[model samples]
Target: MTTPRIVSLVPSLTEAVAHSLPGALVGATDWCTHPASLDVERIGGTKNPKVERIVALAPDLVVANEEENREPDLDALRAAGLDVLVTEVRTLPQAVAELDRVLTACGLTTRPRWLDEAEAAWDAVPAPERRRTAVVPIWRRPWMVLGRDTFAGDLLSRLGYDHVHAGHPERYPRVPLDELRAAAPDVVVLPDEPYRFSAEDGPDAFPGLPCAPVSGRHLTWYGPSLAEAPAVLTTALRAALD
Candidate 1:
């Protein structure tokens, strides 16, 4: 079968599809910013994609993430006779596996070289010698944290940082700043994403704690970015120690 024209709704998946299949992607959400030179039609945001515009594009398939997109939009696309491939990747291993599934489903008869390289990079990293307690705040104001059963939490756990909110009832729970600081974590890891936390902005929240400002893509994205995440995150985490 001929490879289908694609529209990617998730940012990470957008980069994955664009890099792997090139011009296969005809449309993507405004948030799909990787490959910075990407020139696809902007369908809108992940949470709020322009379904009518997407249908108007007449794409053969739409790629979306279960967590990043709502079902109603996907339902609407399906109702319009468009094929939608939804992925769920909540762990490191799942990310690798799901990407494989997505590519194959997208009509690649063979796995891409970058996928193998990404898998190899994760395999080369040894288990942490010592685990440190950390509180990873994804957003402020309401102060949402990485709580139970999340991809970022799992990624950090594998990298030797135990999230203080791992047992919280909510996947991304909102905790008070004073309570988070009182947790007395060994470090506070800030990712430059969803909230755009930076060295100047994030560290100030936890005055006495060590703060490691890292790239959100390295910590969260599961595409070609995974190939370099281990090294990138370790370097950022190490900087917090000094």
Candidate 2:
């Protein structure tokens, strides 16, 4: 079978597909910003993709993630007779496996070299000895935190930061600022996406606590970025701890 033309709604997946097959991606959501110069038709945001524009592009497949995209949008694309490939990756292993699945399903007979490098990168990681307790907030106003079964939480755990709310029932639950600060975690891990938490904005929330500002992509994204996540995230975590 010929390689399917894809429209990606997930930014990480967009980069993966674009990096692997280059021109295979013909359309992507506005949020798919990797490859810096990716030349694809814009189909709006992940949650609010332009179904008509996607259909107009006549792509063979539209890619999305279960957590980052809405079911109604996937249903809409499927209803339009466009094949939609949805992936569910909440862990590093799942990320690697799903990338292989998506690539193979898209017609690549072999896995990409970056996939190997990404796997090797994580495989080389040894468990950090000085594990610290941390509160990782993804959003501020109303304050949602990384809870159970999250990619970011797993990454933190591997990097030796125990998430204070890892047992919360919701994957991301809103905790009042007072409650979060009162938790008295060793550090506050702030990612620069979802809410773009920065040194000035997020660290101020917890005056005395160390705030480790890191890239949201390295923490959450599971594509090409995964190759460098271990080193990049470790540096930030260590810097904050120091």
For candidate 1, what is the lDDT?
0.90
Error of 1 at 116 (Å): 0.8
**Off by more than 4 A, model 1:** 1-3
| Cα lDDT of model 2 by residue, 121-187, tens digit | 9889997777889999999887999999998898888888899999999999999999999999998
- Model 2 earns a TM-score of 0.97
The sequence of per-residue lDDT tens digits that candidate 1 reaches over residues 1-242 is 56678899999988888889888889999988998999989999999999999999999888888999999999999999999989998898899889998887777788899999998998888989999999999998899889999999888888889999999989999999999999999999999988999797655799878999999999999999999999999999999987
Error of 2 at 240 (Å): 0.8
Q: Model 2, poorest ten-residue lDDT window?
A: 200-209
Spell out the clash pairs found in candidate 1.
none
**TM-scores of the models, in the order given:** 0.97, 0.97
lDDT of 2 at 115: 94
